[model samples]
Target: MRTLALRGGARVAVVEAEWTDAFGVVTRGRVQLELRDGEPGPVLERDAGFWLRGTGVRALRNPGRRTARVRIVTPRTRTVTCPLPNTWRNEMSSMNDSGVVARTSHTSRLRGLAGIGFIAALAAMVATTLAAALARAVGVDFEIPDGGETIPLPGFAVVTGFFSVVGIVIAAALLRWSARPAERFVWTAVSLTAISLVPPLLSGAATATITALLGLHLVPAAVMIPTLARSLRTRTD
Candidate 1:
């Protein structure tokens, strides 16, 4: 039995000497199998077991931005090590030194996402405020019967900005913890946006006010969802 470590984006070719009669299990992160034609194959997640013998697998790849490990079990009593070329070893060594390279790369991605989120939030605020003003001009009274008070124009900007920040926080959390962050954020944001429409429908406001409120709610969602999702995809890919 032996363990093989693959750094992010690393690939190891399969040699008969090492892989013959070997069964591999993913112990951490993910491992992607490369087919004999150089096409991508199924990705094995943590705890998944696979056999390479008699399969047209060309190589193993770590498709994620984290280290992945695989445990190899063979019938031989001796332990075997996966041999990497000198250049690859040097690169891995540099990446392992204090983990500076990986940390800096991850931190920079987060910072970039935060910057994009802030800009999108500011734009959503301005856009929502303008839309509210236009709706008011068109005789859509921003009044709610429950409160018997008119919602001011500035209220639109403040609310939009606040919720936009919340969206950013959710996106950042997903980016840090989720494997498919962009896809998950899109689904989550869309579900929340759909839920947000309910309050306006039940606000007991006039028809024009309800319609305007629904449109206003969607305005920020349109601005923030795609912006944050795209930023996340860029970083993850």
Candidate 2:
């Protein structure tokens, strides 16, 4: 037995061997079969097995950004068997007299979600900064009574950038572990955003300043939540 690892977007061609017959089981991540005609075949999730002996499958490709692994088991003997499409999905049947069969499936795709989350974080930072600038331009003096400190423009940008990155980290973590990442991330982010508003309300600032700060708190959330959720939904492999 041996293992092969494939990074996202990597492909490995299958060549016929004279001395060994190999069957592969997806040990981690996903592997998509490439048909001999050059079209993509069904994606096999972890634990899925395929016999490479006669299957029309020309290659194995990793469909996501994470690394995928396959365990290859080769037999010392060769025997004549029925022609099986190289791109067979689901299970590999035993060719013994008993004719045993097995089948299974798995679901996950996080690399795309991480990429999208990073983009969303950048957009959220920009949007948050622009919203803060717009508020400042409209005569909102961001002076807090607690510290009597006026919030600077750079302060807004720095804070927004920091929190936006945090949002991305949260999203990536959920995608890695959560069964329903989109729903779970939305719920967690929204609850945290709500909690963040309390600090602005307790700042004892002027009503205008307090309201503007609250809106600023929301700007990053507005940009991040929907974008991350959409990516999670649309990019599931």
Candidate 3:
């Protein structure tokens, strides 16, 4: 058995002949499988073992910020030891005929996306709060006829901040699990925005109040939906 250390974002092309009868276990960090057809396969975390025989796995890539290591065990007759850099080059050249290439994104990109998403959420909250304040100044009392209580400015800020953070969470989840995260996030956020409008229309408030509430709902959605979708596309790396 020999260990292969891969730097973050490093890729190793797989040569079927060389890897025949070999099994590998992820000993550190994470490794993502890149299929022969250029599509992504499963991501194997630490302790995951896999065999490449008869599988269309084209390459293994390090998908985290730190280095990843894989322990490979081959048949006793085929066991060999060599410097990793030279071994990687030899394997890559051997697979030249099959045109297998590695494809993966780094973890740092995902972390950057999270940072940007949080900032966007804060900006959306501020914009929504300002919009509420402007509406109040224009004679929208923001009063609910049901209980005769006026919506406070602080309430607007608090609710907008809370829901904006919720949008960030949904976007982050989609980024982690969805294959087409940007498109899926857009669809989900738009659906939620549409649903939010119903509550205002059913609040039994004055027409001006209902309109202001509807606009407030849209204000945050407008800021968040596009921002998160754009970030998702970029951080997909």
Worst 10 residues of 2 by lDDT: 97-106
Error of 2 at 18 (Å): 32
lDDT of 2 at 5: 97
User: Which candidate, 1 or 2, has the higher lDDT?
Assistant: 1
Q: What is the TM-score of each candidate against the true structure?
A: 0.62, 0.57, 0.63
Backbone clashes in model 2, listed as residue pairs: 55-85, 55-86, 56-85, 56-86, 57-86
Scored against the true structure, residue 23 in model 1 reaches a CA lDDT of 62
C-alpha RMSD in Å of predicted model 3 compared with the true structure: 9.2
lDDT, candidate 3, 1-237, per-residue tens: 878898977899989887776657676777888888988777666655566766778898876657889888776735456423554445544543323333224355567777887888788878988999999999999999887999998898788888888888888787776555678999999999999999999999999999999999998888888988998766543
Q: Least accurate stretch of 10 residues (summed lDDT) in model 1?
A: 96-105
Q: What are the runs in model 2 whose C-alpha is more than 4 Å off?
A: 1-110
Between the candidate structures 2 and 3, which one is better when assessed by lDDT? 3
Pairs that collide, model 1: none
- The alpha-carbon lDDT assigned to residue 71 of candidate 2 equals 72
The whole-model lDDT of each prediction reads 0.80, 0.72, 0.77
> Model 1: per-residue lDDT, tens digit, 1-237?
888999988999988567766667677877777888998766666655666766768899987778889887777746446543454345434542122111113456678999999999999999999999999998988899986999999999999999898999999887776656788999999999999999999989999999999999999999999999999877655
